[model samples]
Target: MGSTHAPVDLSSEYAADFRAHQRTLRLGAMTVWPSTVQPLLSRRTAKLVRCSDPGTYNLTLVLEGTARASWDDREAEYRPYDLHSQNSWQPCTVQVGQNDQIVRCVGVEIPRNLVALPRNSADRAIGRPLSAREGVGALLAGFLTRLIADTSAYRATDGPRLGAVLGDLVSALFAHTLDSGRELSPEAHRRTLTLSVRSFIGRNLHDPDLTPSTVAAAHNVSTSYLYRLFQDENVTIGALIRRERLERARRDLADPAQHGVPVHEIAARWGFTHHSAFTRAFRAAHGTSPSDYRQARHQPTSIPERASGGTPTGSADQVM
Candidate 1:
């Protein structure tokens, strides 16, 4: 959640202790060492040490020379673009070669509450190692990259908005990692359904028969479920359709080309079957008749210009 950068010196004197110290850092934070040069002697000795707290969970992506991590009684070799994670407060040892290495990594400390899912669910979703090779991994990597790059622009005033963005990104990442598809969480599924329903409604705005049932059928969901999903948003499916149609008509009437088109034709084009109904609704929403509004918009320019004579006389049009 917070980040800072400092130069690190990994020499023989402090290398072992540093490794031991890293193993105890909190799980919720991660460190990224961009690039550093290693002395030849350290490479030959392979005296690199890395460790993390027992309750901490972290992910590391190696971008350079060979490196290995020891955890869970097993050692895993890391290659460029390779992702690795750990669950529980356990020690992890990482060995890197002497050649200059560059690595860009993100470490996440999973919260305690999140660690308490059903045994099998936890193991599959959170407790075990998760790879960032696809889907949510890709999204998280991109989001973190942008977050780190734009940290300065995200101020206290922008906390809620930024927090929402982060929360969505985390939800998406976890959902993909769990492989629960659309069945994982009700909120996640609702978000997806809402997006789909909105898209369907927008595309079918010109269809006069586009109703809640039709939209639900198009997405293979029941009309009741569709209504339930949008309940919290405080708008009904029927209202959305009417609003979209009126919006389209309002836009067309304001356009110069549609100036020559009849108001009723514009209404019909956007799926309004009855002109009188459309006019009444439009007036209620906009506080003006469509024709009057359109004419007012086309009022002439107020600037005046001088009239020109056929030719300029030598005496400047004087009576001389």
Candidate 2:
């Protein structure tokens, strides 16, 4: 991730955050980088990288602002926390808004063979903006954010095994994002089932009746299959539902436009019908009541880093 200085007209902070995600890799070559730049229309650069190493699937999480990605028949706009995939072997371009604005993104380059997904499925996912807030996308995004934020925690001894697990998850996420009904080998079916469940749950989060039974019934899977699918998640469907709701609520509460909206109303909007219950849950998850969290966010400066909706400090990766 090379650093390019911005035009003199723009704020110099443009390139400052560019350096955050470019930290050196301690985990083999899984370098994490947080970057804010325009589509690098540089064939020579892409070619040089291709010559040096195996082609990769570049996965990105837009940490702040928005960016547009285009490749083949697939072209899409991605926003903050949205995940998207691109193949390093092909020519692609991604650009952000003008007016000196910068779009922050966190990216990781996965060697193509390490992804474990079929070529067709990965192609379908390319340039598609996957929902990072839910499903396999959620699980993968969260893990990536943690890993990038704390790369030092990972020892060289953990490399091969963790890399395999990472590949498996990335495969599931790509398959889930595309939802392309390509027949898979027997080995893929088990991972496919869990991905389907998570996607179904994410789509139906607004339905207060989105219980495990309803989820299983909708997917034509028995409750037992649903249970087996999520065993690796270490969280129940109910817990996931609540966590997703609270995350959405946290983003809304931090938004200035939503300041006029009542805290209880915001909770109900995300499927929490009971005010007291929502408050309790919010406090339990955030270590403070929803009202207080919102109040703190609006107090002018010194807003909590999470409330800012920007890339976290000391982010380890950036996308070109």
Candidate 3:
């Protein structure tokens, strides 16, 4: 809302019944906000923009219902999975939801200077709907969704690094749209490519034939170039693949629902062709064999009693 961009004036015919839920995750200077809300019309007038311009850009991906945004004589309508952006320095209006329907979306806010695009070029993208169904946009959408879904998995120290990755992905998507991909800084390109390659590896971890060469080919980069991409990461491409596969297998083994499944079957499910090798790697990484790890994870412990119980105190005016 206004916390990321300029404050807006909001109204709705369904005002009496309006309600909203929003969860915010701070990623260093960037913020990820996932919200579900009733229908409303919001406007950021020139006066508001002048009074409070954080010099940031707000990118929104609609996950449900619909919305329309307009600024500088430009207007665009967005449906589920579609992306649209608004600049804090601009005056804009957004009408979300319809016929009392609820709207859901994830929004990202980053400093304008971090985008690695000229101010004018970036402004041209405001209020323009970008497709999040494929390419870098899809990758970004998935990254944001995962971040919001499991904020607890990341430590506070990971925020700035995560924000940099998001910024690189956003810059790449915008550059691709403007046919200026070549203009991105070398670091931005490298970071974006690294993220893309990691995402690809994650999706294909179940393929036993997956290797560094195959991964490079899939991304249209040479094997040597792929190695160079991960130079700063301190882990080779093959090691990264192996580590990810082992991590996935470890998670499955620990799931109580899969406890009845054989350890070898769990290993094979994550592309481990040899049970012995899987066992060795799992132990090296976790200090325990897969079976032992699963046993320890599934062990039950007595629950602690709550010191006190009462209704949670919070304001009903928690509007998104």
> Which candidate gets the maximum TM-score versus the true structure?
3
- Those runs of model 3 whose alpha carbons end farther than 4 Å from true positions after fitting are 1-5, 150-158, 276-280, 283-320
lDDT of 2 at 207: 72
Model 2, CA-based lDDT: 0.66
Candidate 3, backbone clash total? 0
* TM-score against native, each model: 0.44, 0.53, 0.82
- Regarding lDDT, does 2 or 3 come out ahead? 3
Ranking by lDDT: 3, 2, 1
| Residues 107-164, model 1: lDDT tens digits | 4444323332333553444323445554455545554454444343343334434333
Instruction: Output the better candidate (1/2) by TM-score.
Output: 2
lDDT of 2 by residue, 132-248 (tens): 887677777766676656654454566544555456667777766777434344455566566566667666666778888988897777878777777877988778888988898
- Give the range of the ten consecutive residues with the poorest summed lDDT in model 1: 1-10
Candidate 2, which ten residues in sequence have the lowest lDDT sum?
2-11
lDDT of 1: 0.55
Pick by lDDT: 1 or 3, better one? 3
Number of the top-ranking candidate, with lDDT as the measure: 3
What residue runs in model 2 are displaced by over 4 Å at the alpha carbon? 1-21, 24-31, 35-53, 71-75, 151-153, 181-220, 226-320
Please provide, for model 3 over 1-320, each residue's C-alpha lDDT reduced to its tens digit, 9 standing for 90 to 100.
Answer: 55545688899888787799988777778878899999999999998888788899889999999999888777899999899888888788999988978999998888999898887887776665588898888999998888777554465567778888888888888887887878788889988888889989999998999999999999888999999899988999999999999999988987789999999998888899999999999999999888888887887653233666654332111211
Clashing pairs in 3: none
